[model samples]
Target: MSLDIKRPNSNKTKKKMGFIVKMQLHNNNNRGGSNKRNLFFVFFRSYYRWILWFFLSLYFFTSYFAGDQSSPSSTTTTRLLSNHNPSSSLPSRALIESSAIVTPGIFSGMKIYIYDLPARFNVDWVTKSDRCATHLFAAEVAIHRALLSDSSVRTLDPEEADFFFVPVYVSCNFSTSNGFPSLSHARSLLGSAVDFLSDQYPFWNRTQGSDHVFVASHDFGACFHAMEDMAIEEGIPEFMKKSIILQTFGVNYKHPCQEAEHVVIPPYIPPESVQRAMDRAPANGRRDIWAFFRGKMEVNPKNISGRFYSKGVRTAILKKYGGRRRFYLNRHRFAGYRSEIVRSVFCLCPLGWAPWSPRLVESAVLGCVPVVIADGIKLPFSETVRWPEISLTVAEKDVKNLRKILEHVAVTNLSVIQRNLREPAFKRALLYNVPMKEGDATWHILEALWRKLDRSYRRSRVLSE
Candidate 1:
């Protein structure tokens, strides 16, 4: 019985034991691997969601800030014409082509009417008897030529013109006459003319209305004062009151109209004429016998001493250099070719009716050193130009010293001195050829007014919409 029991179930028991051990080991490995995989997936999913949200927020904030910074910081660029330098080099054809003294778009397509009455207004009298009138006429002519040459400008009859320019020469005092009694009378006439035209053409009132711009070239303050008085008497319209532009070439009286824009045009010979005069000039130390002061030899009523003082200086110069330099005092002519005399090494510019005279411009153009008797004459364009480098202005009390200075300049190298006078800025004035600083002033003022008017029109249109 013991032998039979020992061998009974060995094979069956061994096989069952092997199968249970293998199954338990396999289940344990599967559970451990599944736990590891689940833990890794949970950690990765959480961090990925956070990273995606962070990137989205960063992109949105950066885009919003960048857009906010770009909207308001904008500007415009404008090109300015280059200044001319006569001393450095000759002007190129392109520069010369681009060089226009007055730009065309300044008038905004408005036609300018210039009234010239040669019969009632004597051209000979202006050239010979009235120096002031002569200067005014010259300035007007220069402006006229500039405008006519410009393709953008159109000269129309006063009746058909968009802008009317009238130059009235008055001789009588304000106390005299009835219809043209005073400067005020002239202004009233002007105002009446505008009103009349407006009544005839309704568009004139609708377009320009009381804002009509007027430019008047008067002989002196009598006209200017008269206009102001008339404006007061007639009660200036709100629009036309401030639109008057007055220019007095040689007025002794101060202006009463505080609001009016006043301009003074000094006498100036054109650069081309000055050049011709220089070319005709004699070589160093040679003088023409007929060279004399043209125009009026008499002193200006306002400058009595200037007349006598200038004559005395001339006498002294004649006495000293008469024999050697051929001192010729023609009554009012400088050898018929005034530019030649101006082209000479020295030019004597005594005090005249105005502080700054055309002589300064003439001297600069001719490359001559002007010996100015600095007393009452105020220089034109002092704001933008340097006088010391351009001319020799000496005190009226220092004529003797001035003479010595001129003598020194004569002996010094003239070419270098002329070069100094021919700076770029100064040359532009010459090349563009302004008769007086007042011309430039008027141009700039008108230009500003036009721009303001244009802006207002644009704003009104925008608002209407």
Candidate 2:
């Protein structure tokens, strides 16, 4: 707060010293401030860099780990082919080949023989007509095709072919009052036929101990009955009874035959094609009530339509409701009829004299709600599938209520119903060929029998040794 002055020389020295001391103090203070500013900047820079690095590392690491976890494994790619191989307990190619071989002819390796029957069999309803000849010809054709495919098959005279494949008419003596064959009679006839063939041909002598597989296009019960009766009549050992594989289309437990493996082949129509066909058909309002019965009624004089109901009941229903709804007789090739059924709210499936018909498959394929009339007739392949889960089963007495039920369905949501019926079993039945799919079931049972037979054959060989 006070200033002092001095002599010139002493004052000059004092002033210089004082100036030097003041400069040194200011320089010290400036150095301290600079050090503090530099330290603050270094701390700030390191904190920001650490945060950026942490976030970058986290983002990259998370993305890499996520990609690894989301990828699928190789095991999922080959799952479909896994169940089809013989090594996995399925039929081997050798077994199928041996079974398919026509005796007395060349011993060809495994091959599938497709038998195409003449259209006449479909047309002929009565027995002893040219239809029987057609049936025999169809069988012969199948055998011929099999032999032609393989040069190894020894071609004998028509009477002496190594194997004879026959398509027994659905109307044979073995069948019931309905056109379907009787299981017991069918089995007996088949057994006798096999024996007759064995006695007639020398080639079958070696096959006696071995198992043979046969696929019949007739109903399942007929096939089973034939096989069972054959085993008993031939005095086939108890062990060998299970060795025969018979593939059939229908299944009924009440029949005397055992339940062999079988497959249900349903009719199928492509969805888009069906929709387009329906668009061209006449409106439901425009269809005449008596159009279906005009001409065909004479051909089917008993007035027995294949399904729906008996002639008497159908007549009553027509009389009562014919004015309200049109009833058109369905031709197999009618695209419009198929489309109308496909687009309909409900499809009526009254059992014919027979419980199982092609119509059931057709209805399911169309995605139409099948209204099943549960009658005394036993359903084919009912053991393998649940009818109610996919279809609406109505009692025979309740047949009159079909219209009301359909009306109710129209008010309900249809997409949900379609979704419910589209199961894997239904799809497989619709897509695959009937005889081939039946052959697959036959293959399964035959494979098991073959394994047993092979073991027996091996044991006999060892005993002989």
Candidate 3:
């Protein structure tokens, strides 16, 4: 096991090299090298997040908040306006950037290309609804003007449309029924519109009409007779059931607002009436009138659902308090109803044939706390507005106990509730004022429809996979 070992030439050369290296290190440490290294680590541990956050925030803020508003038709600005605080003049770039992730520009620059529906669908449809100052005709006017005037929403080209607006005035056509077959005209018009859409664009056929918007704002029993499969009044065909339906009478048991496609929009207010409500101040802002009701009290005994008068809510209220000192009751529509609404501390809004009533909007507009008696009714925009804050809902069966319910609301509490109703935000909710008015009824409904379509798209993608 012999091994040959070579002895070190390291004795002279290795020792000299090590000594030189050690002297260099000692000289560097003496000149504060260790202090500089520790100081560098200290700074890194203390302020790195603030530095990183500042740059990341800057990138996103410049991208979203500074969106191209100069494009008069830009939806990007509206989307940005919705997600930020209304009073926020300028938020810190980081705070806004954090929110930008969740509030995405899904519809930025997206166009709502309204179909140039035949004159029958629009102007002619106006004649059918304009005979009276009611919700159906009012809706014809409101929905039509909102889309036509809002430059930010409409696009002249169908090819660029993100969502198609089908101006199907089903309620307006149905308004002409006089114990005769008036539903035929509306049904024929709607059927023709659907046929035209199917023939003209692959959009309806490809999506099965899921991307369309139909404003069928009528009492369920009054319109959409197609749900019954009636040949004459069946305006909304079964194939188009997937489209977004906007109406006021979306009862929970029937319409079930929890569903994806049904949107509960505000019933129309006459332009003059809205202007009048907006022009005058309430008298003393006091509950001088204990309660007020002015409408038909006749019950449709055969109509047991009591959507309008079948439930005996009106009859019960009239029977119990018809001549009460403080409660004012009118058996028919009165001329001073608007003034009465402003005077009343609580306005009685009983069901007629549906859970929703136009009086809900009227009362809110005039700064009266709405005493909603619609059973199983889902209030419109309830996702954004808390109903109980500015209104009260008594069970349809509790119509007789209306006074007791009002009694429970303390005078102090009633004042607070009235104050809530008086808010410009609450008033804004009850009316589809006009175009370019942010956060009004029409704006909320369209925004809701956009969200519905977005969710539907996501769901379909997941299913396809």
Please give each candidate's TM-score: 0.47, 0.42, 0.71
In the range 1-465, model 2's lDDT, one tens digit per residue, is 888986568677667756765665667577876555555554466478888899999999997886453212212211211223322576434323333322221223222222233433322333344433232112222322233344333233422232323333333332336533344444454455456546665433564613333434332333332233343343322322433333323333443333432233332233344446547545652322221221111222252233333433344344444545544443235535555555454565654333444455556655666666535434433433345446666665664765675566657644555654554444333332223222222222222333343334333555799
Write candidate 3's Cα lDDT for 249-301 as tens digits: 56666432223366778887765676675455464655578888898786333
Deviation (Å) of 437 in candidate 2: 8.9
Worst 10 residues of 2 by lDDT: 73-82
The best candidate by lDDT is 3
Model 2, which residues run further than 4 Å from truth?
1-253, 256-320, 326-336, 376-386, 409-414, 421-425, 434-465
- TM-score of model 2 relative to the true fold? 0.42
The better-scoring model by TM-score among 1 and 2 is 1
C-alpha lDDT score of every prediction, in listed order:
0.45, 0.40, 0.66
Clashing pairs in 3: 226-234, 306-311, 307-352, 307-353, 307-354, 308-352, 308-353, 309-352
RMSD of each: 18.5, 19.1, 11.1
Model 1, 1-465: lDDT tens digits are: 355446568678667655655655566577866655555554566479888999999999997886453211110000112233435576534334432333434465555544443423324334434333234324544444444444333455444455444333332222434422234455555555556656665434554632334444332322443223443344433444444343333323443432344333434345566557767776673533321222333322323434353434444444444444433333344434455555355666664332344556666665666667646444543423345566776665665465466666657655565666655345434332433232243344344344434323333455799
Clashes of 2: 14
Q: What is the lDDT of residue 369 in candidate 3?
A: 85
Each model's number of backbone clashes? 14, 14, 8
